[model samples]
Target: MTMPAFVKPRQVIGHHLVLRDATPADAEFIVALRTDESKSRFISKTSSDVSQQVAWLEKYAQDNSQVYFIMEDREHNPVGTVRLYDQQGDSFCWGSWVIREGSPSGYAVESALMVYQFALSLGFTRAHFDVRKGNESVWKFHERFGAVRTEETELDYFYSLSREAIDKSLAKYAKFLPGGIQVIAA
Candidate 1:
């Protein structure tokens, strides 16, 4: 059977938030979050310059191997970002999840659910990602979502979640996105 191509949906609308494809215009916002002292501690470091981020985004536009998104609330206010990449057969990796401080509650759960739903729709059966060793809250969240600890390194904890686990998590958190998400075509 022919494998499915990665999807780059224009939008994935949920109950409280919507994820839209990232653009160069979001460079400053992305840079701001990536450079925030409190938020940057767990994720990889990036250049603080918005122009650099713009260049990176321009390059990213040509790469179909990944999908990057900027999350927004109903009013179209930017709140966070997430990405899916590093595909290997039926498995894919997702990361760069960061939500703005002071945002309303339940966003985290909704974002995770939306990500899994979007990935599943693209035909990915499993996911593998690493959480920083110091990011206890994130790792714990994944554990509670049924992701298994597969290994670890000096700075990060690797985890794996099968399709079954993903489905379970989606069901468990169904309340957060009771109406499910609406994916708009690219």
Candidate 2:
């Protein structure tokens, strides 16, 4: 079956950033972004090889369960990467999210709000992800969106945010979403 547009939107526009689908051509950037020294400690280990990244994207292209995006600034400069994955019954998982270390203050908020809006628009009732236990900074970051801790593994803390909860938190960040988040039709 064909996945919905929110699962693989060609482009998602926010006030300060635009998230575009990651193409095979973006393999190099993805590799560099994920392997960058500054951001490496926050995420799980990823391939440093371009060819390996390309192979992964090729495989991902066929897997409707995962969607990758390259987040860029209003001027179209790469900011970071994010993904919505593991589409199952009524919930999906979201992560692979990162914003460039020194990107302007707004990029981080825009990227996250866009993803939560995208998931809700696509009919997902809930979203889940795990942040490293040591990453207290980001744990607090996700809290801004009403994410509640659901699990605590030795290495990570899992969070679950319901669409209802996310919606309630939208107003707090509404000023950051330019067009006020275009919710796709069901």
Candidate 3:
């Protein structure tokens, strides 16, 4: 199904930032973001060449099971991206990588909000993600959203949360978010 244009365009956040879908045109930026040493280390993936990135973006654009969005700053500069994929039944997987390198305040919050919105749009009962084993900061961040660790491997830690849990957690933190940050489902 085709998403509405309003939802497809830039989603504003308190007049400071926007979140929107990524395109094949974002290949260069995505390559750079993926290559950043710190980000790469945590994500456990190597950077792709421009051609490879373009191909990957093409595949993503054609895949209904995945949605990727680019986060832009006030000036409309693309700074980072988040991806939601692997939808099956009521379960889906999510992943995010921010390569803004000293981004403004609330970037992480914005990313989390996007994840919540996407999961809801997909009608997912639960969303899951994995953080590298040593990425304590990210693990704690997920915990703050009420995500519980369900599995721990030598290399990564897995976290999952039900739809009810996500909604309750969002409600619990609503007062802390910026005004106009609506969670829209597809």
Candidate 4:
């Protein structure tokens, strides 16, 4: 199937959450999440300086190749962040997923479903991503979502989920997102 070029949406609404484009004002929240001692271990190290994060976000805003999102609760209170990038043909890589310590139980699953659903609507038929070797919970979550482990390096485990797998997940998790996702173009 021919896919149109990817266009970032202004907002993606899930059953219980909202994912909106990250702005420079979100630098502090993003920094805090990235710098969290427990969470930072698996991801790349980022500077603690908010201004540096702002600058990075500024650059990110100008780059249309990726969509960085701030995940929020239905009330619009920010709870986490995720990003979709590294498009290669019909597949895209997604990571930078992090939920706040006290978020409700299903945010991770819902946010992930939103990502897949939104991407599918944009014509991406497959998803590719990597998890740190030590991030057991996350990798296991992907496995449960039908992502097959495709490659393994000393430091990371790469995985992929085809359109079929993603479709299965959307069905299996229908209750968590009963109405499906709705993306409003930016």
Candidate 5:
């Protein structure tokens, strides 16, 4: 089976931000982003050690099923992180998403559309993700895309989106991501 290219985007650019694959050079920043108390509550992993962070990056480097991204504003300042991983046939997962406090309101929304576009561009038919049950903000964000909650873990709510739903959501949000979606830029 063919893996999706969003796993390692050279650079998925949109109106408000750029999403690129994570590298060892980003270890410190990734650590800080993932550990911030505000962001850590909803995340499953909270280890703050940089060496361990780099080790995780190294392992991800070899995993075709995962793609970790560093999100930056057009001015090139790191603002967030997200990942698309856990491919099972034509479906995959997207999450590990976090944005800094006080970012422009639309960055998260547009960045998510970029992720869905990248996944659909790879011909994948479904996208799955989990949100901690109490993370109302993130949960609502996913809901806007017409995601349906398919399961509930003790600590999280699992949501899935059909390709058709994603495509439709993209249209609803296209104005926010001007230039459409060039998900894979060679």
Candidate 6:
């Protein structure tokens, strides 16, 4: 049997945010963005130096196992990033972060929606994420997007959403969204 395609590049937009894949030239910005203490807390890995970041970026450019996107404002200012990885079969793991302090509201939610839409476009049936413990706000945010808590472990809380759930959440939020929120297929 032939393996099915489950990945692709995509662009998504919200009222004040846009999400798209990172380019080779984004290494420097990514390095700076990931080094922030607040931003790095929830991330599983950290770059110790610029060279390390560059190497990671090079690998990311070549890797089919992961997809990364930079979140930007209306004026094209970078505010944060989101990544989807560990894709196997019909499930994938994902995460997002806002690198700049108080850059704007809605960065995380916009990034989340982008990733969810991307996953659906990729033929994924479900998506999952690990939220750090004690981050009640983040938990609530995920729940607001229709991610239900699926598992609780010593390190983090796991949440998941199926394609049906994602669609329902999007439809439910459509009335509250501004005119700019849209998911463009890759």
The TM-score values for the models, in the order shown, are 0.97, 0.90, 0.83, 0.97, 0.92, 0.83
Q: Write the per-residue lDDT of candidate 1 for residues 55-134, one digit (tens) a residue.
A: 99999888999999999999999999999999988888999999998888899999999999988888888999999989
Q: Which portions of model 6 show Cα errors greater than 4 Å?
A: 1-10, 175-186
RMSD of each: 0.9, 3.0, 4.0, 1.0, 1.9, 2.9
> In terms of lDDT, which candidate is stronger, 3 or 5?
5
Global CA lDDT computed for model 3 = 0.71
Candidate 6 pairs with clashing backbones: none
Against the true structure, candidate 4 has what lDDT? 0.92
Q: List the residue pairs that clash in candidate 3.
A: none
TM-score of 4: 0.97
**Candidate 5 lDDT for residue 107:** 89
Per-candidate local distance difference test: 0.92, 0.81, 0.71, 0.92, 0.84, 0.72
Worst 10 residues of 4 by lDDT: 1-10
- How far is 81's C-alpha from truth in model 5 (Å)? 0.6
Candidate 2 residue lDDT tens string, 74-144: 79888899999876666778889878778888777878888888877777778788899898888998887
Residue-level lDDT of model 4, residues 79-165, one tens digit each, is 999999999999999999999888889898999999999988888999999999899999999999999999999999999999999
Better of 3 and 6 by lDDT: 6
Q: Kindly report which residue stretches of model 2 are placed more than 4 angstroms away from their true locations once superposed.
A: 1-6, 182-186
